[model samples]
Target: MTKPLKASGFLGLATMMVVGLYQFTLLAGGNAVPGWMIGGHAHLGVISILAIVMGFAVPVIGVTGRLRTAVTGMFIAGQWGIPGVVWIGEGAELPFLMPTAFLWGICLIVSMLIMLYATLTQDSSGIGGEATGVTPADD
Candidate 1:
């Protein structure tokens, strides 16, 4: 995969791992012995999963053009908005997992932006010159 796609995938995986582990920790009773233990970890997990799937789809499938643009935009919006909503609804007292969630959100947004730029401007090599053989000229 291209650098942007790789970055996006890594960010997505990181988000999923962090949020999933944090939620599992909470579900396994880790929030009880903490001072900044909000239950937003579960929401983070959901967001992370979405990010992971979207990131994977952006690079894996032949979804260039406006479809790719739309997906990347949605991914960015979700990554940032979900955490913002969680933070707002859960108050400012973030737990141990909050930082990871925030980082993941930023990474997702940045990665999606990169992917969007590449998709919009780069040639039809389909990320890293993978050769989809369906260039704009062919269409």
Candidate 2:
């Protein structure tokens, strides 16, 4: 659960950072919230969950080499890049973020599907395989 812990922990930290930032906006500017703030808050939860899921699946799936790299990139992009783009788009008043969002969504979904497939199909080392030094007798 180390990877999951780190992923979720970072998400928690990011959530708190947003909380403080929004509070600052409220105090200094008075009731004017940037769309990016809302977007970041909204998307971070989804991304965080995705990250945690990936973290858990990583060890079990035993992904290696290029597949690992691809999955990692997709997960990170989905978790951070997409929402960050929205945040920037809102902040900079860019209208082209929609296409980027779609692309990111596709990347995220594909990564999730791959993770799912791998997790479902991979051979589980099973409980105390190390202790017994045998393949899983059964699920």
lDDT of each: 0.56, 0.68
Candidate 2: residue pairs that collide: none
Candidate 2 whole-model C-alpha lDDT, 0 to 1? 0.68
Name the lDDT value of residue 110 in candidate 1: 68
In the predicted model 1, the residue pairs found to clash are: none
- Could you give candidate 1's per-residue lDDT for residues 1-139 as a string of tens digits? 2234335545645764676676567778845423222344444555556565665656654566775666566565555555555565345654444455555567557656756665677556555546567767754
lDDT of each residue in 41-139, candidate 2, tens digit only: 668766776576667666656765666667777777777767767767777778687568888888888877776766666677741134755677686
Give model 2's clash tally. 0
Identify the candidate with maximal TM-score: 2
Best by lDDT: 2
> Which 10 consecutive residues of model 2 have the lowest summed lDDT?
125-134
Runs in model 2 with CA error above 4 Å?
A: 1-12, 27-29, 125-139
